[model samples]
Target chain A: MSERVSRTTFYKRLSRLWRNGDSRPLLMQALVVLVVLLLVVWVINNTMNNLEHRGISTGFDFLSQEAGFGIIQTLVEYDESHSYGRTFTVGVLNTLLVSSLGIAFATVLGFLVGIARLSANWLLARAASVFIETFRNIPLLLQIFFWYFAVLAALPHPRRSLAFGDMIFLNLRGLYLPQPVIEQGLMPVLASVVVAIVTALVVRATIRQHRLRTGQGTIAMPWLLLGVLVGMPALVWHFSGATLSVELPQLRGFNFRGGITIIPELGALLLALTIYTAAFIAEVVRAGIESVPKGQKEAAAALGLKPGKVMTLVVIPQAMKVIIPPLTNQYLNLAKNSSLATAIGYPDLVSVFAGTTLNQTGQAVEVIAMTMAVYLTISLSVSLLMNIYNRRVALIER
Target chain B: MSDQMIPARKPPKQSVGLLVWSKNNLFASLPSTVATVLIVYGLYLLLPPVVQWGLLDATWWGSDGTACTTEGACWAFVTARLDQFIYGFYPQDHQWRANVFFFQLVLLIGWLTIKATPGKKWVLGYALLLMPLVSWWLLYGGLGLKIVATHQWGGLMLTLLLALCGMVASLPFGILLALGRRSNMPVIRALSTAYIEMWRGVPLITVLFMASVMLPLFVPEQVVFDKLLRALIGIVMFQAAYMAEVVRGGLQAIPKGQFEAFGSLGLSYWQGMVLIILPQAMKLVIPGVVNTFIALFKDTSLVLVIGLFDLLAIVQAGLNDPAWLGFAVEGYLFAGFVFWAFCYGMSKYSQRLEQQLHQGR
Candidate 1:
């Protein structure tokens, strides 16, 4: 009888523990935490053992060592004597250069094609659809290869280069355009431009306040702002003795000299990234514009608004809410896809820092970790900025 | 009034039929007419040369570079090296194994597509469980079959295998991660979130590099990773994060009432998810899964950067051949066409599936 009473009491205690408020969940969570910690510990321990056995000491100190390889393209000052750390910065800047240019060109082209797809003209709409489908469906790598090897490489030599008057030249080497040489006085001109911008902003704000108070729209303020922005820069350039000159490319020996040279690698990467991404962006833009209700367009038209005004006032603003999120995603994708430059020897982050540096130093862990961190930082920053903009544009309900 | 009405009899010949349609569509405004003219002129300048190069003046059959006598595309190179392009360095005799594997895949797809297939759940479960093993046997060779190394594997075969295995392996892990992310347990949520974000934040190339170069250093000294296996691991990890996001989107779409209903039935957490929630969630996410698969298919091309002989890599190899040095254009175009066809077809199918599934909602 005593044994049975003890068993019953034990069971009662067990049941009480199970029924305790939130303790079961807490226990389960703790168990999960324990398992995760153990797994991480195991992996790290194994890695350490492996590294020790392989005689590869893992640390980030190698970043300060000299990198002895030449990069084809460098956005900042870099050479073979520079440390790996500087090479990393150079790689990152090159990546940024390609991504930013690609984004700008892709956006402009994408918007044009997107609007064309909705054209009343049947041929224009069909052409836009064909363009989107043709470029997007092909693998971007193949497109890059085509641009690099088939099209650009097949260009004539510098002596017989294709030229547009005296301004631009294209050949097997690259596209050469006149380089703008800004003289010393250009600094003051640039400063005046900044001042004009600030003044214009203040003037615009005051005009907005005046219009809000008096119920009269100040239309001339926009022209005044534009005038200040353009006129100020021109006047300063003229009076401040800023001498701006264009140095045209001259064929020298085997290559062009004096002008800005766009290497074939950059041209191929830029063109492929722009054309490929533009197709997807076009689709996003089309979907955004279509998502706006037909009733809204009709309502705007009924309000005596011109077709262009209706598009600007009613369609675009509403469509942007749907467009911006996907647009940001496309931008991120283009940035990531720029890493494909390694395949074509574009000296991107992965190619220069991760590929060549890792190979030379045999410090795979440190090189890869740093490269991944750079990308992660970029991705997160882009997301945070876009999210803030998205929130601002999002419709709020009372 | 009758006389005025009698005058309105017949419309002009140009104001009817195709002419009228063209007038409304192509010549409605000055801008439209100008755009039409420019587009037509552009096509006029572009289409014939492409057609002549691709079809008319192209060499249809030859064995060497010398066979391409004309200025048109050297399709002869693609034809001559077609076997290498398709199978990479796989032994010609063992190419039959790849064919059999493809056939099995087709059969499985056919069975899945047929609406009236009986015992579908059991068949699908069995196939899902057994297909990987069967494929491994067919690919790597075992049990009286000649042993074929992964390095010998390349071309479309390797691309398909990598994508299929990655998609299959990632799906369950993605589901678990997605569940953990939404779980009440804080530790599990944090772990899942970190894993997803870390993988998603980095480019697949970096992940590939880590797997190819660093994975060896992570494992025990005696253990070695095959190049294909390393690339596969990277691909699976990268894809799982994307898959988890898609699955999470599906999970968030499910109503909270379903969870409560499962709770009222005295179901455990796993039981509720498995029986009540996941089925609806998975159904809603079929399109997303297919889209991810398409992306994975395209990404398999990146294996070339890691020195894997995928389809793109094989084509590149062919381009490097001394005999076919200048025929890169044709080889790349052929490979591009193949990839485009597959990706485009799957995307279209996904759209159809999405539309069908959407109607049920």
Candidate 2:
């Protein structure tokens, strides 16, 4: 009788398991997990065997070995005697330099073009449209080629460099500008600049709070902030005995000898990234501006707000909601597109670590994995930062 | 009273015509006038030279590089290498195969574009399933035809082939991924999410590198993948992740009531999805799909990094040739123009499709 009862209970439990919603999905998931695991295991096994047969070690020990190649451009001190790890860092820094510069230039250009596209003047609008269409339609790689092979390469040699005043030169090699030499007292100037920025932020916050509480606006904050930021730095530099010296680029054998030089590869990559991304950003900016309802502008004007105040308080704030998302995307794309510097031998992460290092070490898997991880980390961090900003700008409704 | 009406006076001078229009639009404020004058001056300084260089002084036709002696654009170089630019090193005599394939492609695309095409389902099936095979056979040459190595395929032909194949191959995978991501099963969703995010997060260059270098290690020792095939696989994988996100957006737009309606009919999950859900969802996201295609089209140039002689690569190669020295400008301009034309055309078409679909809905 006890055995019969146990059998009945077992059957009931089995039926319940089969009939439950959660159990079905759990079973299906388990099967899927098993299949995926099997595939991964097979691939790993194959990779191990292949590596063994090919006599290529699968670890990342080669990163510590010397890199015997010279990079044309580097943000940090690097030489052939440096390790592959140093090469990787140089590549990452170069990429960051180009991408950051590209972002800054593109944002300015994009905003200009975007506003011009909506200009009251027909000629201005048409010109902006033409610019957008021309840049947007062409592939970025081709544009890079245009700048590198055609434009920069076609420039005359250093002996015949194009001079802008006494301090700047452009030639086949690169743009050369006078390098600034800061003297001992420059720390005071730098400190004052930092202090000015913090003071500006505090002042702006106070003004915002005062306006919110009293419904009265103070317009002096921006001018005051600008004065503190620029005036204080200038005063410190002038009176604190901080001597600024310029080291002009001297023409040497075949190239300029001493000064800051922007290599053609970096120049071309920056130009292409800026122009191409600016075209897309212009569209985003245009769309965002257009997305703001006409009523918002009218309502602000009806409230007796000044033209600038109407734009700042009503139109731009609303437009930010639409613009921030797409703007973030463009910034991310600029970062990713900077990888194309590889094609032009720009010594970017992909070119240095993935291309040269991998070729030297024959550690394809490890090199590629590392390069990919760097990009993934950059992408994730950018998105996280942008998401926080987006949340603040997002419309709040009760 | 009509007879006594005063003769119609000329409209107040500043109320109409060019003067008023300019005043109202261009010179309305100090800033506006400044912007107008600056832009006009910039255009005046820029436009004439570009026109002269691009049109008036440009060389049109020549047999070789000598015909392009002038400083202006050497269209002659473009003319000299036009065939190579279109067909790459695709054999001189077998170029007809590519021509025929392109012709077939045009017809298929034309048919697909027509709103009232008869037997739409069957036509779509034929175009999607059979056309790729036939085109592949023709282009690659197998079974009774002379086989053309994929390495020989370059230029515009290679570009189109990569873009089309990537788009076609990615669609199914992307759809499945999108579905899996939205599935109730935890493991499938996690896997799909991981795959999609990883692909989307990294640049396509790294992906291509992995495919070119590391893929061989992942497969068995005996297995071989052609260079083009490996690049294509990488592109397909990378694009599919983006396509999945786009498809997921479409899926989310579908109302829950549609699922309920399917359930009311006692339809299975797959049946409901295949028949009702996906059709509506895909229809909604046609513009997104086309945009992805445009992006893929542009991205095919990256294959050059993997040593594929695509159109841009061919241009670079031509520039390197001693015969075509100092003609990088013309070659690059030509390549850029071609890419621009194709991308711009596709974008306009997508915009039109979006408008039409919006109206239909």
Question: Which CAPRI quality tier does the interface of model 2 achieve?
Answer: medium
Tens digits of lDDT, candidate 1, B1-361: 4655455757678777998999999999999999999999999999999999999989978878888899788898888887887788899999999999888887887786677877777767756577878898998998989999999998888888998899988998999999989987788899899899889888898899999998887767678889999999999999999999999999999999999999999998889999999999998998899899988898899999889998988998888888777887888799999998988887887898899997987
Give the per-residue lDDT digits (tens) of candidate 1, residues A280-377: 99999999999999999999999998999899889998898899899989998999999999999998999898989888888887889999998899
On a 0 to 100 scale, what is the lDDT of residue A307 in model 2?
Answer: 89
**Candidate 2 Cα outliers beyond 4 Å, as residue runs:** A1-20, A216-220, A395-398, B1-27, B115-117
Q: What level of docking quality does candidate 1 show?
A: medium
Q: What is the TM-score of each candidate against the true structure?
A: 0.95, 0.94
True contacts kept of 2: 0.89
| Quality of model 2 by C-alpha lDDT | 0.90
- The C-alpha lDDT values of all candidates are 0.89, 0.90
Name model 1 segments beyond 4 Å from true.
Answer: A1-21, A218-221, A395-398, B1-16, B114-123
TM per candidate, chain B? 0.93, 0.94
lDDT per residue (tens digit) for residues A246-274 in model 2 = 89998878888778999999999999999
Clashing pairs in 1: none
